[model samples]
Target: MNHMLLTVRQDANLTDNLVGVNAMEVLINALIKSGAQRSSLRAKAFGGARMVDGLSDIGEANAQFTLDFLESEGITCDGHSFGGTNARNIRFWPATGRVLQRMSTDRLIEPKTIVQAPPEGNDLELF
Candidate 1:
């Protein structure tokens, strides 16, 4: 049986998003809809990094929430890697329930290039 990987977390601003407190509930509903038996399902999770500097540890909150959710659902979390200052990349193999986690030195606040698109059909026509 294949395993499902759920990477859940509490947002930095504590916003409710896809990977928040309802993550397990969402996954369970989807699995049931897809014809999976509750008894046959398990979870493995990763990620919840405190990568941003000078902020609350949302990662710790995320990790704890996930664990509690799994317990409440009676689903075994076979393995997990959560809560740290480093950014992480995950490679998961559902067939074997294997995960490879790589930690990177990249900060969450790294600079990004912002590209602005022109308004539709508004070509700059300077006469």
Candidate 2:
């Protein structure tokens, strides 16, 4: 029941054609070298939470880039989780192709109580 699962972030510019060590091309090559057939390859992508406020949604952009890349490369994307304000924690099991995603939730933290020591008994009467 041993399998290899790879998770990596793509370059900000996917069209640049730069093959970085962690780039998709390298990942596919590594899989091939490890005896996986390209035709049978499948992917499950996660993350891309919109964590900021601005004109550009970087998270959505990255997620879209991944889908586009996989599509262009003829790879099947098994599933995806995308586009949310909350952060996400993803756990993927390659052998089972199972993905567990947990979204960030707001929780109120109770403040700790600070105890102050009483003044020393009359050691220094003068202030």
Candidate 3:
């Protein structure tokens, strides 16, 4: 099976100007355009790490946006790892919705832990 990996950065310009829209929106549209059926395509979201104390909400918002968008689109979220005081190094396999999240605690805050589990089967529906 072939897989595509995409990275979404925190910079708005990277998402908006380059993709011609917001990151989450563009991601969903791309998934559809790429011939991903709602039932067959699963999502595994990562990042949204806070890194800074006061800026924690940004990560939360990103995660929430991702989840809400996926749900509204009737796409299954097979896995996720989100929201922390540290950044993450994530690897995603778009075809299978498999994700690996590795936290980075080199400088700022506490140690990070893995947050999600992979989906079981197609019956673990999203919408």
TM-score of each model, paired residue for residue: 0.73, 0.67, 0.59
lDDT by residue (1-127, candidate 2, tens digit) is 2233333333345453344224778888888898888888888877666565443556666777778778887888877877766666788777788878888894423346699987779676666
Off by over 4 Å in 3: 1-25, 109-127
Estimate every model's Cα lDDT from 0 to 1. Answer: 0.76, 0.66, 0.59
TM-score: the better of candidates 2 and 3? 2
Q: For residues 1-127, could you state the per-residue lDDT of candidate 1 as single tens digits?
A: 6478978554733465344555557777888898878887788988788776677878777787778778877888999989877877889887788889899987677445699976678587767
lDDT of 2: 0.66
Best model number under TM-score: 1
* Runs with alpha carbons beyond 4 Å of true place in candidate 2: 1-11, 14-22, 106-127
Best by lDDT: 1
Q: Rate residue 38 of model 2 by lDDT.
A: 88
TM-score of candidate 1 versus the correct structure, residues matched by position: 0.73
Per-prediction tally of clashes:
0, 0, 0
What tens digits encode model 3's per-residue C-alpha lDDT throughout 12-111? Answer: 3324333523655566567668776545656666766667554335556556666766677666766677766677787665556566777886676555
Q: Return the TM-score for candidate 2, rounded to 2 decimals.
A: 0.67
